[model samples]
Target: MDDGQPLFRWSWVVSNWDNDSPNSIVNLLQAHIVMSAVPVIVGLLVSLPLGLLCVRWRWLYQPVSGLMNAVYALPSLALFMILLAVTGAEPVTVIIPLTFYAMAVLIPAVVDGLASVPEHVRQSAVAMGFTPLRRLVQVELPIAVPVVLAGMRVVAVSSISLVSVGALIGQGGLGNFFTDAYQRDFYTPAIAGIVLIVLLALVADGALVLLQRLLTPWMRARRSA
Candidate 1:
């Protein structure tokens, strides 16, 4: 403990809460939320079109998947340093790398979700005289919701946790706690950060589950039958 304080103290968290400073608990948490959320939203949006293309043209899947895998393999810290030079924006430095990471997860999720549709499901849509676009919107995608939500749950939790890594460059949000713990030799902030992060991940995952339920009511109906 720094200054003879205990290893973990709620007082440290309480005193720092929303103190209106850069390092305050509330500020770091809010920064953490934005830093985490923007990438997932952007990644999902980009993956939808890309995944649809990959599914539509079978040959495209290999090249696209390979590229995403390569991108995924790149170290997050290394990318942070590299992107730092390319832009003057501080948050972008973190957001850009995290966006790519989310895509690496979400693209495959989108593809797998689409692929999960049964062959009979497709035939039924066609038999109903559904156009390609209408079929995708009304028939195929609704059925694919569960699988896609599963992937989203994974991405959301991981993304929330990963935001802490951004602290190395000073954009880490709650991740700054780890660095602070190291520098000050105080464990309180670091412990609090971890607890808060887990809670945030749980909340995000639960929200996704609720969304999945709302989107796929028939899943329950099928289970009962």
Candidate 2:
């Protein structure tokens, strides 16, 4: 409407696509990908151990869950604003809060996955003389993979969405395009960025699902049987 042609024309998107400069579409997209992925990865590493600890000591679960939920409930914008003072608008400001949110989702998933294993299976492992660590690493973790991967899918998609919110702080991935378009009243970049982001989320979720299938072939076998 603003440009006389449709706002989301493919011709405009093609014209704006630049690969060489840091501000190019490709670079912005890469930045977005890195920004989204790093927090989730860090969250997974931290939350898995913490979730296991919570399982080991049931008393810790309530407190930890409460804390993470509180953190997750905090507005992302507010958290970014608060962290800006400490981190000075660096990428860490965005990554740190995103990591916290990722953990909030992941910890519960890990806990539920572990808890889903039948008590008899755990008992059998104990009877078979499996050490606590060995049972956890070899038996319990493997069985919990499907549920944990489900959580990872949730976190990954949400994180990808949230990366755009980062653009408000000048740290957004593909989200920057929306902000740019709004300010300039140009639709091509925003539309293209959104399409790419949706594709990325779909691809990420599919990969996680595939990984889940790979890790739990018995589930597939049982389904076929």
Candidate 3:
């Protein structure tokens, strides 16, 4: 009941959990999950092919990578605004920028992972009569899975945090909570929203880590050696 302790009180948040309309904590959390996840998935799909292309065409790597890096460096909000002009205020505007940012982080990791495959391994695959495409698919990509997954973990965490920013334009996940709290001069929702976002990021990172371990048991064995 103390007015000054609005944000710190666990009781108020618990009490408000089932409140009507858009302010429901469950609704916001669900929205946040969807907004955070979709962009990363789209980015991974696009980056995988683009990364492969960069690796295959050595000459294209520099320019392509430079472009991605530049895109990554641009502010997320700024990028969102630019996309707004063309894509309008829809979710696609947020998603496109997020996807490009994910690509920027992923492409270098993918390119490096693919390049790191031992020359001897590649030669051996060629000797065994594997075509370039077959060798890439059957051997190189398998070896690169760990590094690529590491990049994915990074992308996933970043995407989760950034999803909140979309709330600036009413497209955010838990970001709306922060905006609402600030507008209403109440901090309980803001506090809850941030906690959830961090937990979501940690959960996502942990899942990716587990996936990497499952996919590359050899790496685990090598590490334990």
lDDT of every model, 2 decimals:
0.88, 0.88, 0.85
Clashing pairs in 1: 166-172, 167-172
Q: Where does candidate 3 stray beyond 4 Å?
A: 1-4, 15-20
lDDT for each residue of candidate 2 in 1-225, tens digit (9 for 90 to 100): 454768677776666677565657878888888888998899999999999999999999999999999999999999989998899866788889999999999999999999988999999999999999999999999988888888999999999999888888887878888898899888888889899999999999998888888889988987999
User: Which residue pairs clash in candidate 3?
Assistant: 167-172
Q: List the candidates' TM-scores in order.
A: 0.95, 0.95, 0.92
For model 3, residues 151-223, the per-residue Cα lDDT tens digits are 8998999999998888888878788889988887878778888998999999999999899888899998999
Candidate 2, overall lDDT? 0.88
Best candidate, lDDT-wise? 2
- lDDT, residue 44, candidate 1: 89
What lDDT does candidate 3 reach at residue 168?
Answer: 81
Give model 1's TM-score versus the native structure: 0.95
Residue-pair clashes per prediction, in order, are: 2, 2, 1
